[model samples]
Target: MTAPFRPLPFLSEARAEQAAGPRLRALRQAAQRAREAFTSEGAATALATCDLVSFPYPTVFAFSGAARSPAPYVMVRHRMQVVRFQQEGTERVLLFNPSDYERGHEAPFFKALREKYGTFVTTQVMTRRHGTVQAHLEALGLTPEDVDYLAFDHLKAQDIRRWLGGDGQPAYFPRARLLVQRAEWDAVRCPHPLERVWYVPEGTGGVPPERVELLSGDTWLGQGVALLSTPGHSPGNMSLAVATADEVFVMSENGVATESYTPLQSAIPGVRTFAEQMGWEVVLNGNTRENSLEQYSSMIVEKVFAGRARADGGFVNVHPSSLLTRAVMAPGLAPTITLPPPMSGAFTPVAAPRHAA
Candidate 1:
């Protein structure tokens, strides 16, 4: 069972270390600055309580089978918060996928796939049933009674199409738009020529209403900053780099693993191969075995950290709640930053119960 959502305090150090880039030298410099800031600011005793908001998104489950079966089941893609910020003083959560949730298990399907395929090829398959509901409603050209269902299917299908590089009609959503890098946009030919698509440049833009901001640099919004493309995982997988008065942080969702040891390089192969038929460098266990658990784990950690920063008074809260806590409480002591456990339930895998043969 997942724990109830709780507003977390900020990391005081994050504010001071906000400029830490991807380089080790920058990271070390940021750390030092964070320590100094903690001593001067005088830490707050109690944590702040803030309202938490999240978008509803579907969950994915992966299963593995034998060679003779369909293909090796691997990887799941669920909606997750990508970048968060304040709109007119109200906290807004930007979701990668906002859609209706469905419950289905993939284990049985894997069993059957293994039986038929012998050595299953690496692939992630969605049930035909999943797509049918959306197709029927879409063909009508009339909005379905449940807009959520339609939206869910549209988003899921888009993800699938993008992965497959298929030439099917592009999916469009009036309420939300795809926030993509300039390079990615360059490669894609808009199926709907008249449809408007917002292209975010590499870093710098106010959070525009109804327009997704594609960022390229480290720029701050109300509470967070946007970090552009840090590819190695996926061509388009990008992260929002952020910091406050004390600590520095990055939310590289699905781009890196939550666990400290595993990096995004480890999980990219399986999903990349299944989705795009492209070979990737597997940094985790050298074997090209398909598994993305670690990759998702790493992403979850970044998500929680970002969430906590928001809940608290931005990055200032990060340090006191994290490593610089002791230093802030007692300035003379050696600065030792101990990161808290990641926000709970940020990356729980959806389990598929049973699939029909």
Candidate 2:
């Protein structure tokens, strides 16, 4: 029998937020102890990121909690993170948010949004491809087969057919199994009227059931890696936490930029004022409002777990999977502080398993 994913103790904070007093404090203290133990286990062998696409994103959604902005849109860069680590003494690879930029139009929301408001609102800024997932993997000395698992922070605007061999097609990552939250998987397949716009119609259709791994809650993957269940941006929303030689980095769409995690320190025009007035520590990526409070709590979990940047203690090391980037197309919406892509160690091919003679 296979061992199950170890649960992180910090998750109790998700439920503790309702009262949010002494009980919450007790839960947090225990959670911090768990975090310390988890971090002490050591870091992953290697981690790297690849830029996939850059496009205009609504200022309203990017800074939902602090929505007063002159700019309607902010240019954002969506990236794929590849992490290699040892599990049971064997090298394993995890690909987080490996979005296929070319097929992004398949999502009903983007397709109709582009068709109706393309000229006035977005125009050519809807989608911009930087490189293919295959190319990036090759450049890093990795092949599709080397990837053991594939996961996304959430399933919004994603079409997994190409990667998982759906609808009578061959898979791009032959050996990869999708690690998704069961709630997210269910929501994507049959979204609520409000949630429909963000998902591709029939996106998960024909995906081989055997290739999908449904996770129930926060999961510890191995030395230095865990998936934090961060619902609210979307039901079953999750964030990837990875420990490196320098520090741990949490990746999620729950927030757009570093400022999202540290709103009090933000220099963006309206971010600081809104956060101060609302008494908010973190600004949410509020595409969905169903679980805003829970999402707020989850971002807290990510911030606490990621801790502060080693070089500059001002910002927490919470990296958005689709990080906000400066674009000529979207003016007046530049991130006050930008972090260079996080990297650690080196990427090398996974050794083939030995066969007994």
Candidate 3:
């Protein structure tokens, strides 16, 4: 069996918010301040808004929570982002964690989850736009072949075959090279017991070997674009560190939202409780409970890198609730919080993984 699910340590705070008291008032004040950061008029700047994000969707996992909802449990979201820039004067288009490959095959992703979690989950990806990679590229006025490179923080719920092709299907982005960490690739072949249900069927089975550029540890796909292994959410879990015009942005699922890392200070009740008790760094992602200790470490690493790398506090979590959509044009979807500038320097580079079976 997979490791036991660790319940959030802030249940009391959630309960506290229900009662009328000084603590409740304080918590409500904090929560309100946090919500204000997501409004368009807030202009809360830490990390610059993303250049382009794939269809923003809510994918409720077996026990995931909806964005900003009172639900303190349940992992959700799972969105993607694509970046475009020039390296040494060469135009480059990089897709970060490209998902929603084929709308035709959404059921299998959830079906696999049901098999492993022993419960039916609503795997639907709620998107106002088309939920396909092509749609993302189209929004940017580009095509799959135009993509210079592709990378994923980790490949737990991802289906590379969706883009690389499988089961006799043709590759989605024929010209792009997949920059996957060697450790992440290994897990794709032999997933941990807890991860069996998160991936797509035959996800990487049909990829052409030449299309993959596997790295043993941290690596640079291009100037100012790097793949760093953070490894907590999944053994091979990693983060993308990109130095952009606005500032440096760290994209990882570690915290899953701006709410995870902030003001060494925050207003959200659960966040405030965890921050006060566990220390602000104790905040972590909504998924993966097997290695709470390690995940905590990973989130710390993420906080340091993200906090320092950007100013606006936009860690660019793949699963940030709609309430904290850093750059969206919608209400309650704009970024609200900007952590004080990162205090520390860059984190130690990722080393090759030492797996435990």
Candidate 4:
């Protein structure tokens, strides 16, 4: 008789407790000051007031205490910023989160965050305004009419479809060759729809030869840089590790957030299920959707602790939660990129075997 197939166990309660140890307490303390400033001055003024802002969420605090099991965590989907940096006269401009397809109607939400946080948060405004088609043209130093045929074209139709729902034709963008881990790619294509849904591309074609490079094994990308395959949130989701001149920054893509601590008072069951499938650990911060300063502070503290511990010896920085504030604040500390040495022995792919559809 064949043994029954078993799923990986969720985070154990014991693990969760350990995860929220003393390190978490320190982070919470730091977050308290930030949260107080945000509430007292409002998000915008508080952000403008900071000497150096790292992750610019409108507010950061804790809401829930502990959970019985390691179920998927839920985070409040608030307005966020997309960050990118260039090496100055190099072909490589490290693009953080690219321009999202949803806009126009979504501008109010974005505007609200900006209003609360301040205008320091910069987005690929041109892309957000004109759509990815035009944005990629600008990236390649070309105009829409300049190229005879669009190359390296890979668009995420499903994400577009969801956000655009009943809107006009979904936007498309130039396909850059991604440097994703093998396990991450498999998780992205998992049959469990929500597990890898957000970033699962409908198609990947029109790729340019010059722009595509695949990293097959455990290897660093740039000098003293590594890419981690963090699969809980999205399948192809990965974080960047940069050991810089000053500190080590791990750019976790879809990890936990301050809002994830809130209780599920009125979350859509379907959306909650989706969040779970994507591997989030949600807790209730309050009985309502509205968050309080204390709760925000607690959550931020937890996130910081977890983020730092995950970085181990490296210093860490996260993408700002509030876009408006981030745009204005100077990049805070030098980024940290930590890469644990590869395990000794022949490398084996960590992906589960793909089943026939």
Candidate 5:
């Protein structure tokens, strides 16, 4: 059963760190200086209670499954991200495909890929230097227990058991509950031929039934937060949409980066013209041809979500969150990757779940 949401007193960065041990407290000293870089963007009301924490997890993969295409493969930048959603002083942690953080948790997805793909994925993608979410939260003086909710856009390549321990095993965050789509959970246990390589065996085997929250369709999580079923990459794939005062933001692998989302606007030479000539609709995030059609449709849903970033007509573009890549589609076409706009006081609350465009 899901526990009732409880609002905690907002902790100042300093006060939050006070409870941390000497070793853990030292993490804050550096973050204390880094905190100066976080801005509330003065007077601007945010669309949601959203915060973005990113680290490097580079990967070399194709932008889509389009064969005989220009810019077939490239390196990804800022691939790992931890998004926090807060409402009425209560907060939830939404990990965007959280896996492969050097020394954190290791998933079968990483191990299999390394064995098949070799050094690039092994040395650069899986072992990229990046701070783990545990480390980042500790810097903010928070532990997993402080988290109320955990979710992902989908379950592909996710090894979640370790994160939600049971059967006498200790979970990373004891009090937190996991939110997963029913379809996603089902697929994990019995994956399609294409995605089998991504699932961790018995990833959910040890998770207590009470620790899981299952969803069937698009649902609002809070005032300005939602999880949308944007299946394409996988049967149960989903995406997260958050509205803040400045603009709404989404975290997903639907389109690895900005260029994948808007191919026409892509800076990758010949991509725009080639896509136009080939009559290609959308690009799949993965290279597999299986479920290619769904992947294509999923990007459309993602495009709509990104467009909600601003009401006055701004479009949403992912910042390659956690993945830092030198490859830009084009200097003129690359969108500036950034977190949602900052908040001064109250966030721009969504009255209810709006229709997906």
Candidate 6:
């Protein structure tokens, strides 16, 4: 059985260093065990990615202080991961970051963008929606009713109201429970001034309390999947770890690119030199830096858990949930390398179980 979630402790520089060694050792062992179980039981069936939308994001935030590009913005495309697995002879589905694009614009950051860039440029020229999550589910022969769980790395632009039904509205995914960190739940409800910009106003307001599952810390959902608490970007930031046939994939918004974890090997002009000069191993996404040290530590945990990528040993298998994409709208700002959905196998929709008459 999986242990119940608990609160993660705050990490000072010294405390982070002290905890890193033991935490890494334990993570490695856990990953190894999960992999073995996956092979033996065939616990995991398939994992697929759905591209949602692309928009302009600040270049400075993408690489922290490591980027030297003249371009002010970089194009980033957000994606959702659908994982199919089984536990106790029952099939399950987990959706990671299934963002509601229409409701996303209410976020303060996008509001600011529209104010600065003009409505036409910001909405029409720069932002592009690939498809809706509902459409993606339809393509896979699944339904809103079929989704078992919904989660986010951290709820920035997210509004749980529509999905869970709030203020007397009907829910899109009627049966899915939202797995969110307790700290994150609090943070979103009462955002600090620094956090206000990334969130939507009244985003979680009126959402049914029973629809949310508040996790205290790290949690093992099943045999091949776990949700690891990794704070810093937000008070309750977490990453998804899934063990597959070939390798273990860690998904989060911890860093914007694989090169963010391996800056020394980055082909981006200033990244290598900046890493060497600063004597830093990883470059942060740096959107919110108030808790820089703790975020750094959390990122290190992600790096170790992901292990090195098989395609290129220099990089780790940390896939950014909102990946920096190549586009003409954003010039001179493309990631040197990108990892497509690394998990293998195709999703086969499981029929809903019949109840006794």
The candidate that wins on lDDT is: 2
Query: Model 6: how large is the Cα RMSD against the reference?
Result: 3.8
Q: Indicate the residue-level lDDT of 57 in model 1.
A: 13
Candidate 2 per-residue C-alpha lDDT over 1-357 given as tens digits, one digit per residue, 9 for 90 to 100: 126357776565445555645544554565556568778988999999899988777788898847555677787889999999776666789999999766765677667767777644543546677888999999999988788888999998898999999999999988888999999999998899999988988778899999998998888888888888878899989999899877888888999999899998887778899999899888998878877867887788778888898757889888899888877656656788887787888997778862111
lDDT of 4 by residue, 1-357 (tens): 001111112211112333335434544454334223322321110000001112222221112222222222222222211112112211222233333434322333344545654555433321123234344435444332222111111121122222212234432323233344444434434434332222334322233333324433222333323343333233333444333333334344232332243223213223244335543344332322232232333334434423433334332244222111112121221112223311111212212332211
Candidate 2 accuracy as lDDT? 0.81
Output the lDDT of residue 285, model 5.
66
lDDT of 1 by residue, 37-72 (tens): 323433111111111112111112211110112222
Q: Determine which window of 10 residues in candidate 4 has minimal summed lDDT.
A: 43-52
Candidate that scores best on TM-score: 2
Alpha carbon lDDT at 214, candidate 3: 70
In model 1, the runs with Cα more than 4 Å from the true position are: 1-24, 27-77, 82-84, 88-91, 97-177, 187-212, 224-229, 240-257, 260-357
Q: What lDDT tens digits, residue by residue, belong to model 3 across residues 28-66?
A: 344233222212122111121222222222322211232
lDDT (Cα atoms) of all candidates against the true structure: 0.27, 0.81, 0.49, 0.29, 0.50, 0.79
Candidate 5 per-residue lDDT over residues 60-177, each given as its tens digit: 2444433233432344443433445554444444445555334222445556556776857556653435455566556544566655567776665455666778556678867666
Ranking by TM-score: 2, 6, 5, 3, 4, 1
TM agreement with the true structure for every prediction: 0.33, 0.92, 0.63, 0.34, 0.67, 0.89
User: What digit string (tens of lDDT, one per residue) describes model 6 on residues 1-357?
Assistant: 123332222221223335655644454455444434434534357787899998888988988867787788888889898887664455678899999867888899999999998999998899998988989988987887778889999999998788888878899987888999899999999999999999889888899887888886666676567687788889999898777777778888978888888889888768889999998778888999987766776777778767878877768989999898887755666788997665667876668672211
RMSD of each: 17.4, 2.8, 13.6, 17.0, 14.5, 3.8
Query: Candidate 1: worst 10 consecutive residues by lDDT?
Result: 148-157
Tell me which of candidates 4 and 5 scores higher on TM-score: 5
Q: How close is candidate 1 to the true structure, as a TM-score?
A: 0.33
